[model samples]
Target: MQRNFEHRKVALGTCGRAYNTPCIHEHSCLRCSLLRPDPQQRGRLTEVRDHLLARIDEAHREGWLGEVDGLRISLAGAEHKLAQLGELTTRTATVHLGLPHFSHLVGRTVR
Candidate 1:
């Protein structure tokens, strides 16, 4: 006599829900899994950029071209540095979050 058994596969991180193809973890639920900076950091950067622009505009309106030009250069440099930092943070977050999966794969391959 032969017996057949059927195995049901449960989605890995969704507690038995149907698997979502795009996200293997199934936790994103329609959201892109991109890392975003903390709200405070985002708000602070916006505030600083707005304040610098306002100051530059005020200096220009008062006929202070030298100050306005200096502020413009400074703001541009600061914005560039902020963008670089944001990129670094995002890369770091991606690597950090992926470490567990990477380790699992490594373990399986080594074994």
Candidate 2:
């Protein structure tokens, strides 16, 4: 899904739900349950995760305690999406199986 924030457009990945529906998260896609992160967008999501981590650190040092909590929540969501991508990769990974042997069947007569 695309989001327009701060005069810039950001692609937050694809939405798994129905199309043409309004977002209830106020353009905060990371923490929303409806967000089905795209595997191709891993880099962007990683950037967001890193940014959130830095923001949390800055918030702590700058005494922005309230912001840190929200940042942490977003961080968790980012990590979760990353994990989902990882799992998808694992599930779709190639596996090799040996070719079938027909030696025993070679001597058998057809029914």
Clash count, one per candidate: 0, 1
Give the whole-model CA lDDT for all candidates, comma-separated: 0.51, 0.80
**Model 1: per-residue Cα lDDT over 16-93, one tens digit each:** 332333445344211222223243355555666688899998998999999987778657744754564567566744
Candidate 1 ranges beyond 4 A from true positions:
1-40, 92-111
* TM-scores for the candidates: 0.42, 0.69
Instruction: At residue 22, give the lDDT of candidate 2.
Output: 68
How many angstroms is residue 75 displaced in model 2 relative to the true structure, after the best TM-score fit?
A: 0.4
Local accuracy of candidate 2 as per-residue lDDT tens digits, 1-111: 244331232376766545555668777878877777778899999999999999999999999999999899989999998998888888956778889888987878877
What is candidate 1's TM-score against the reference?
0.42
